[model samples]
Target: MNKKYHDVFSRLDQKDKDLLREYSVKNTTGVIFDMLKIFEEHQEFKFIYEEDGKQVNLVEISEMLKAEPLSEYGWIARFSKHVKDHEII
Candidate 1:
């Protein structure tokens, strides 16, 4: 694990760990970078799962759709979409 992202991955649960394993256990934090580079363009996390020939997705809702501002919407959803979902980003 890279020290820079230790704080991020540290906060995730075991299931999320398993999800990251789909990326690779030796470099799980790569998914975060993928999310920033790819998913941000579409408002949700998605990447090619080449072995399975399908896109793996992360559940993320736009703060604008929620009733609260970013900080308070975190009170409701960080990753809350139901579409082709895997876990909260």
Candidate 2:
């Protein structure tokens, strides 16, 4: 895992960590990946998975999103659409 990712992952709460793990397992990379990709395009991004420890940070994720140019309505619409499309499958 990249150092930056490790640092970010160290800050996740239990709930967010669980969600990330679940998403990884299901190969479902929608909203989270979208957020990450946005950050990655501007900055750097990485993923870290640890067997016996938490591997991501919700606060950092929040901060990254906050720093991005995602409009509130647009993000919600995109996320909603992605969920709706996924549910149809």
Best by TM-score: 2
Q: After superposition, how far is residue 42 of candidate 1 from its true place, in Å?
A: 35
Give the local distance difference test score of model 2.
0.55
Query: Which residue pairs overlap in candidate 1's backbone?
Result: none
Give lDDT tens digits, candidate 2, residues 35-68: 6666556545554444667776433566455324
Give candidate 2 regions above 4 Å deviation.
Answer: 28-89
- Among residues 3 or more apart in sequence or in different chains, the pairs in candidate 2 whose N, CA or C atoms overlap within 3 Å are 9-56, 12-57
Top candidate (lDDT): 2
Per candidate, the number of residue pairs that clash is: 0, 2
lDDT (10s digit) by residue, model 1, range 22-89: 55623534444453455446654443334566554432433232223123234324555523354434
Model 2 TM-score relative to the real fold: 0.30
- The candidate 2 region of ten consecutive residues with least summed lDDT is 80-89
TM per model?
A: 0.25, 0.30
Report the lDDT of model 1 for residue 63. 28
In model 1, the Cα lDDT at residue 14 comes to 87
> lDDT of model 1 at residue 41?
65
